[model samples]
Target: MDVHVVSKTDNNTHATFSLPTPTSPLAGPSSLRIRPSLLSLTSNNLTYALLGNQLKWWDAYPVPSNAPTPYNDASAWGIVPAWGFGTVLESTIESIAPGTKLWGYWPASGHVVDLALKHEPDEPSTHWIEVSPHRQTLLALYNRYLISTSDDETRHAWEASVRPVWQCAYVLSAYVFTPDPASNPAIHPYPGIPSVKETWTSADADLSRAVVISLAASSKTARAVAHNFTLRPTSGGPLGLLQVTSAPGPIQSAATALKPHFATRAVDYTSLDTEEVAQWIAALKPAKILVIDFGSRDGGFEAAHKLVSQDEVLAKAEFVTVNIGYQQKVYTMSDVGAALASAAEHSKIQFNTSPVIEAILPVQGATKLFAGLEKAWDHWLENREAAAPDLQLVWGEGVVGEKGIEGAWTRLTRGEVKPEEALVFRI
Candidate 1:
């Protein structure tokens, strides 16, 4: 399951990703006991960790105060397995065959299965039911709940289809993006005055501005977030349009569907002479940018910085940067990214770079929340459109299921899940 190790299963993988592991909490590998019969998934549940495992890295316990980075100066550290997620639309699910495609797990592997309802009070409303599981699960724990005309019928349907993986990016955005600066109920303040847009749209400020989702063409979460965004129109302005890619050849039809207000501005970043992103940002003055920057080194931080420093494009609006997080290596990567992202409202030093972490709800202490996420996933599925309680944990893994990409000891070091090379056939 880790990047360095190989599995005996047919899923020969070579993919690499970051992981979070805390030095404290309990160090090193855990011996998991299998109990697949206990697995159940529901559309109603929402919070969950992989198979009842605490999915984050390091001692990301309730922040004693609001200290954002304790690992900033550590020479070496341990990492824990992290996770990623994608949206599994009914249509997309219906269209693709098993093993044909996969969305990132916000950074965790929990997305490998789908969610279902359970009677266990301590568990998430839903749990996993693997029809053709890649790895035989032992003591699997799932979260998320769904509504069916008949409970039995719904249960049957859940058993049939593959459970959706980790947290969907759009759903995660909805949860993490605290659009309203005025209403950001912080145990400790994040600094600066609230923004006008966030203040007016406090209840929906996070929902107010239309997000310009990158990698829109293929990403399930990108498309899902777009769908979710369109359903909830905010006053932030017409959902702005911007798409950038490196893949070549004829444009796919998905590009055209995103038209008019939803403009798909495509370009090849590989051949650019100088930080060419400035032109793109200037052309479409995005209010607050939410990007799904996979494949790249630093959430496009290098390119964006080049543009902002050399060109005047990024100066016009309040810019919020979300990393492909798949690129996150250090604690500062995510910490600073969120700092700059929420900077407009929180007002700190104008950092030209950083990743964002917007928790969907107020989470309990890390351990407790991880302990009871399967039911939480159920609660989430029931109200996909609704915002859950907002807990404040400023760690990198806090958003969606992305925290799964940590090291062996905790997320702090350098360990991670290695996707099966076989997935390349589908990705």
Candidate 2:
């Protein structure tokens, strides 16, 4: 990976520097400052912040001098990068390095330059470089902020950590639906009004019912969905939740915790033949189902299809489902296509996404506790709340450096990443 040195003003203005030839890898002989990137300065692109203002997206890299390798000693934070770079695609903030494996993004902090510059008149992309030693901090941030977010896990294992992705999620959710970020309840089964242009409230703001959370227990998104449902007035009756999961223990405990607010209940796949699942879902004739998982995509669609085929009771509610796992490498491009085809074939449902929170919400922040978000609004929908599944989030992949991106590009072009290396991260 190439590392470059950046010397800037207090407000991140550019300075003079020289590029080293192959023989002179250290300092450049040209005393004049290096040329700045001619790219237009857009408010959207940034690598650092100075007094909340856009500072230069200065490129930092490691010199790898004879001295020991240098690394910033920051604590853990997840929601960092994937393995390559994207031109600020999904999220507003994008960080690309020279060579490093990526998981996701966290809010970025300082960076150390590491690239050795070599000029090419035809190419200016490699002008900036860094080693990306912040991977550990990003991961730790994810575990701390996003994972331990539930009301139960408020005191996370690593409260000291900071992450960007988690912050994004909290902010997006808070911005869209609720205002209070510090303590969004564990079972917000009834999310209030949304500020977004498009939103889907309950079928009849007055006709309430339990929210059917698919892939419950295991998913934090589902937990949030269930929490949204619970906040509603029960003149529509209690938020009778029917959670489906293969893992009974943790899920049941989670559901149990959801108690009176959601009146939590559970069912296993094997029980589908019995009325156990049907009766539970039939209670409010749940108008909506919120899916918080991709791993369950196939099975979830099949289940919804079966229920819709068999139950006239649930026929009235429009089934709403959203897949946020678009970039999660759980399945390759082909696998995702196949999954879509299979879901369409099995279920009458088709996705018509609402851009309530379009950006990929990376979990970032203090470990285990919910910090406030930057912008949050209401969830927009057409089918209303009775629709099964209001949302689903699959942790997306991030961009790495040029060479690492080349390797991923080569593999992606051929087909996939080595299966073994993939297990390390959800992407």
Candidate 3:
């Protein structure tokens, strides 16, 4: 079996190594021996490594004891987890039989792994939670897995690539900036997490009278957010949308295709004319302006923010900036430190999906919430090709060598992957 390992101190330093697969008996009772069959690679995966220690992502998968030389050191090397589908090779639980497919988080490796799981009570039998002691540190969102019933490999690949990020987009649009506040109360940006003191009031979430500016608008999560925006009722808010991205043509085309209730405009990051953008916002007569920085390029977010601060009419409106994602690049230790410090200085409302989902589950029962999400997810899957006309899935095989996960990781480190290409591996 093969697995990928990355330097804990530097994400760019990574390699694949072979390790003997665990034999016969599983690790613990109710545990299943599984191997990741399909997985995805995205800039978000890079964020997992950059904030691994702070967020406990590194704890999800430890390097095997039999790994080669330096890679064997848990303190120095770790396996980054990816969202995808895995098949059970062996199981001890009577309810879960071998060959059953599961969808959730898994190490970006082909090696068989053991996970202790418990059926989530009061939910569908298909819903299970990872009860492994080492995984307890992870958020509920990461530990939750769903038994997949779909046999369409194409849909499975698309889901592996988009579902994880798209869920964040759904929660952001539906709950965070709730359209029907009566049914879905506006949730704080850091809902259920007391450590973060930032408070998001209902007024702040009211997008009805606001012009939303999305930085890094070409990002998968940003694209999904834009798509979800189209689903909002005309009276719900968000008077207009201004998308700033490197590739504006595709985004503009998608907006045109979606026919959102509000006006939409797409502009290149390098060609953002603040005067023109200010005029666009002023014409809308918005009472507030929400800028969502989805980890734009170096000066992209700063430039977009300048438009709001410099314009007299726009400056008077309520200005709110939500930090959702980071740029697609490998981060050094110092870079990670600076990012945390910068987020603190800017008073940015950090959007986390885990706590938000946890807060929503009790209010909107798991069954209902997932049903609504599945409906929307199915819609997105059907129209994804039209929505992202330029985007295409690039599939690879196995864990090592070129045309595999290792090569994909190398390209990610160099920031060579294009925004339109989705990388998935058949491990």
Candidate 4:
């Protein structure tokens, strides 16, 4: 069996190892023996490794004790989970039989894993939750799995690459900055999570009378957010939008294709003029200004911050910063430290999809919420070519060699993967 492991302390230090396959029977009742068949690599995967210890992502899948030498040390090396499809080869639970296709989190490898799962009562028959004791600390979003019905490989590939992050975009638009406050109350940016104490009132979620700026506007999540924003009723708010990205041409083309009611403009990071942007935003006469940072390049978020903090006309309006992601690169220990410190100092409303989904489930119900999400997701999938014309899936096979997941991980660590490429693997 093949697997990939990364150093817990240094993401750049990673290798592909061929471990002996497990021969023991399923570990617990309702266990399924599964192997990740299709998976993807994105900057978000890097974030999972960088924040693994803090977020308990490392607990989801631990290295086997029998692996060779130091590579087997759980404290030093761990598997980074990826969002993808897994095929069940054996099952203790009768309802979920062998050959069943499941979609959710999986180790970024071809090795089979045994997971104890339980059906989520009152939810769709397709919904199952991982009940493994080792995974208890993971966010509920990661624990949950869905049975997949589609056989289309292209669609599956796209889902593997885009669906996970796109859901965050969906929640941010449909729940966080809710279009209809009466039906779906706007959730706190942190929402229901006890660790985050900041409050998010309706006033804070109101984009109806605001000018919104998205840094790293070409990012998949950012583009999805922009697409969702186009669906909002004109009466709901957000008088205009300013997108700052390195590839402004494609961004502007997508905005044009979406045909948002609100005014829209895209500018490259190098060409962004804070004063000019402030003047354009001031003309909108917004009641507030919201700056969403989706892992912008160096100084991109800082530039947007300067526009709202220093501009005479723009400073008068309410200012809010939502920290959604970090730049796509391997982070050093000092880089991680500085990011944590900066987030604390700025009081940035950090967005976590799990807590926000937990808060909305009761209000919207699992059926209604998931139904709505699927409808939106299906539409996006159908129109993805128009929505993200530049995105091209770069597929690889298996887990060990240069043209496989190992190579993909190396590219990610060195930041060689372009924003236009979506890396997927057949394992």
Poorest stretch of ten by lDDT in candidate 4 = 192-201
Candidate 3 per-residue lDDT, tens place, 106-189, comes to 998788888998986777778899998889998889999999988778888888988899999898998899988887778877
Q: State the RMSD for candidate 1.
A: 15.0
Which of 1 and 4 is the better model by lDDT?
4
Please write out the lDDT profile of model 2 over residues 1-427, one tens digit for every residue: 1222211222121111222323333233211111111011111111121111211122121222432222221111111111111111111112322222222222221112222222223322322222244322222222111112122111111111112222323432333223232233221222232312133333322224435445523333344344444444455333465556555455555455434455676566555556556666677566654333323423554664566457667656555443322221224446647766764553322221112222212222222222123111122122112212322211212223322222333343332422112111111
lDDT rank order: 3, 4, 2, 1
> Model 3 Cα displacement at 422 (Å)?
0.6
Q: Report per-prediction Cα RMSD to one decimal.
A: 15.0, 16.4, 1.6, 1.6
Model 4 earns a TM-score of: 0.96
Model 2 whole-model lDDT (C-alpha atoms): 0.31
Give lDDT tens digits, candidate 4, residues 1-427.
Answer: 9989999988988988788778788876899999899999898999999899999999988887777888888999999999999999989998888988889999988789988989967787799989988899998899999999888888889999999989888888888998788877888877755433367667777889999899888888888888888778897768998999988888888888877899999998865554677788899998888888898888887678777778788888988778889888988878778777767766667898888888988888888888878988897887787788888999999998888888889988887888688899998
Residue pair clashes in candidate 4: 208-237
TM-score for each model: 0.39, 0.41, 0.96, 0.96
Write out the backbone clash pairs for model 3.
207-238, 208-237
- Per-residue lDDT of model 1, residues 1-427, tens digit only: 1222111111122123223322232111221111111122111111121111223322211112211243221222211222212233221223222222121122222212232212334433332222223222321222222222232423322222112322343333333343334333221111122433332234333434443535422222333343333333344333454444333121223344323334444445442234444565556665555444432333344454344445554554455444332321222335446634643432322200101111313333323433333343454345332311111112222112233222221321222311110011001
Off by over 4 Å in 1: 1-166, 178-227, 234-238, 248-252, 258-261, 271-280, 289-292, 295-299, 327-427
